[model samples]
Target: MPTDLVLLNSRLLDPGTGGLLPQTALAAADGRIAALGDDRGIGALAGPGTTVVDLKGAVVVPGFTDGHLHPVSGAERTMGVDLSACKDLASVRAALDAARRSLRPGAWLRGWGLDPNAFGEQPVGFAAVGAVLDGVPAAIDLFDAHSMLASPRALELAGIDGPRRFAQASEIVCDADGRPTGLLLEDAACALVEAVAPVPTEGELLDRTAEVLRTMAAAGLTGGHAMDGMRLGFYAELEERGELALRFRIAPWCQPGADADAVAELVRLQGTGGALWQVAGVKLFMDGTIDNGTAWLERPDCHGESTHAFWPDPQRYTEVVGELHRAGVATATHAIGDAAVRHALDAVEKARTEGGREVRHRIEHIETVPDDTVARFARLGVTASMQPTHCCEFTRADHTDNWSRRLGEERASRAFRCRDLWEAGARVVIGSDWPIAPFPPLTVMAGARHRRPSDLSLPPHGPEQALTPLQALQAYTVNPAWTACEERQAGRLAVGFRADLTVLADNPLNVRDTELRDVPVRLTAVAGRVTHRAPDVS
Candidate 1:
């Protein structure tokens, strides 16, 4: 059959060699690569209906895949106040006041990206929040999504009269007199406020997702491993309707109290995931993020004080993990502290011993770890799903930020061990942690490659842990596909693989580290169809 599309006059960069292939054109037929050769050789395969894209000598590489992110939640968060830029209470109030102007009557005020650490010495309390929101009901999530601040009206609406007991580690921070202080830590506590917040409807979810995925496509993301599971069908519906352009692999939350029977049920349910969509695994929170002092740490340091695991029963967690793996389902766990990382590894080891499955299990957000644990990832065949922007946007180089202050100097210096994990032989994959941090892979690559200090005034944090450009590129491209067991279907540009490619204005492999983010994406194609093209791309 004649080729459906011919991408010519481009540099086909080989990720493995960090060099361009001698063949400079690619032919796609039936949504797969048909041929790779010189412009004339591949171009000759193009028939009358074929779309021939003139690349103007741009660099073409495999489309990027985000290792971890919440697609549904990220889209919904954008509907409310984006407090990501707010640095103080007054600014937060100003942002809320501005956001409220666009909201409907009687609707609750909602906001995201609130970082209490910016307050420096100021208190974050209901009184402080109520002063800004006034009588309006409001719920503001912390940047890490591990905690939240609720206005007095919002608390009343959520019926959080006082601190309540939880099955797992959670905190409804209160004052000396037992007055609610507006801070809710961990999912259980955060749920108190969320229980009252309005959930997006099915239509809203699909619409919001379509809007966000387009943004993602233009940024060169050809696919994502979405951490949100219940929304899998939503994306599938979009794919069915041709609205979902990017490929997705969904992992729904695997909660406690489920037994081996539940794993069996999950395996049966997994069949629902199709080509553009898949329910490949379950997502479990082993520990909260370090930002709110909720992370599970072995020994408490002044910087991050909590030593509690999110799971009520560690034995149950291990059993469930083993059960799931035994059934051949992948698992992705959220582990930030060294203790949590160690615990996760132990569980995987236990799973392997019993089930003996070779499924890819990942440890998400490895913010800190013991030196010995670095080699354990590779030895145990674990993937390190890390976010470089977490280090640059949140942690401080001088060990004074919220996270660094919690761990103290000794442990803080070892945070986000990206290079160490890779050098130790672990499959290191990178993601944005979106809404928590920016989602652009190129911008993320800048952080991975440079470890630039959040504040240029300060020194770079853990520059020794920074990744090389090639290593960073692979993290966004090849590593993620491998993590999801889609290496043969996607990740690389080759015959027999899906014709998903990202064209860059400049070759990142040949550019200076600082210039990576600035290099624009000229075009993005998925399955031989052009999803996004720069206005001047022609």
Candidate 2:
């Protein structure tokens, strides 16, 4: 049988060499790479009706996978006012006001990706945004999704009128008089306000999901490990309707209170759906974000100490992780602080003791960790799931951002040790942490390699933590596939592997670090299907 699709005149990046493959053309048949040969050599295998694409000297590599991102939530967040670009509270209000003109009367005024540091010394509460919101009901998610600011009406809508303590580390900030200040921290607190927030219809959900995935495809992503599972059905519905462009592994969230019974239920539902979208793991929050005061740190910072874990009962959390491991399910913990990192590693070790080390568990957003804990990742065979763009987006090298201000220079210097993790023999995976940062893997890779904001004058935050180009490529490809347990089927250009390839306008390995981000994606193919093709691609 002749090849169904042919990609010609392109360079291929090989994992083994950490460089381009010798061949310049690839043949695909039955949704798998059938053969690889030099340019013009594989043309003989093309059928009369074969769809041949001329890459025109572009670089082709395995389609990038997002190791950690919340597509459902990210999409919903994009729909609201994108306050991520706003540099200050005044700028944020201006963007909100601009968006307000197009909204319906009495409609919920929502915003997302609001940078806490952008407010300078101002507290994240109604005092900073009440006048702008007027009488509108609004829930604005912080850039890290760790906290949010709401208006008075929005607070009323969520039925919160005073300070409250949650089982988790979430806090509904209040004044000395116990009056609600419209600042909600962590998921537990966010849930209180979001519980009564507007719910999108099934149709709206599908549309938004489609929009986000298409954008991801254009940005060269073929898969993602969706961190949240509340909308697994949205991805399922997409595949069912043939609109699902990116494959996903759903990790349903597992908060503190879940017991053995909940773990058992997740185990039962693990492989219910195969391939496109599978529930293979559970997400746990070991600690909260550093920008806020909830993160469980190793010791006291300038603002004093916050050494508590996000999970009220750390022992129970460890026990449940063991249960999940015994059931052959994976667990990904959102551990940002050093204490949280150590505690999560301890939990992984406990699970490994009982279930063995074959399961690929992970710790996400490892923003800050002790130097010693770096050895544990490789020792326990735990994957370090990180977002490079977080450093680029949130912190400055001078310890000026909210996160840096909280940790101080001592701990902040060791933040996001991607290079150290890889050097320590740990499998590291990178992602956009979308809606929190840019979703494009190109931008994410550049951030991983440079760790600087676009301004070259500004010193890069934790420059030593930056990853080499080849290592960053591994994180975006095979490393993530290994974590997803799909290394055998995807993440490579082997004949038996899925025909998932992303073609870039330039060789990523050879390009300048800054130029890499602007390298356009020429084509994106998933299993022999062209999900996206640049206008110039023929």
Q: What TM-score quantifies how close candidate 2 is to the native fold?
A: 0.97
lDDT of 1 by residue, 457-487 (tens): 4567899999999999899888988898888
lDDT of 2 by residue, 1-538 (tens): 6677899988888864677788999998887899999867788889897889988899889888999999987787777788888888789889888887877988987788888887789877778864778888888888887888888888888889887778887788898999988888888888887888887777987898898899999999988988988877787788888788987888888888886677777788787664467887989988887877888888866677467899999898899888888878889998989998999999889888877656888999899887799989999989999998888878888888888888988888888999999999999999988878888998898899999875454678888888988888889998998888888988888887888889999878888887788899999987777889999889
Q: In model 1, what lDDT does residue 143 have?
A: 91
lDDT of each: 0.84, 0.85
Instruction: Report the alpha-carbon TM-score of model 1 versus the true structure.
Output: 0.96
Error of 2 at 371 (Å): 1.0
Task: Give residue 527's lDDT in candidate 2 (0 to 100).
Answer: 77
Q: Quick one: how many clashes does candidate 1 have?
A: 3
Best by lDDT: 2
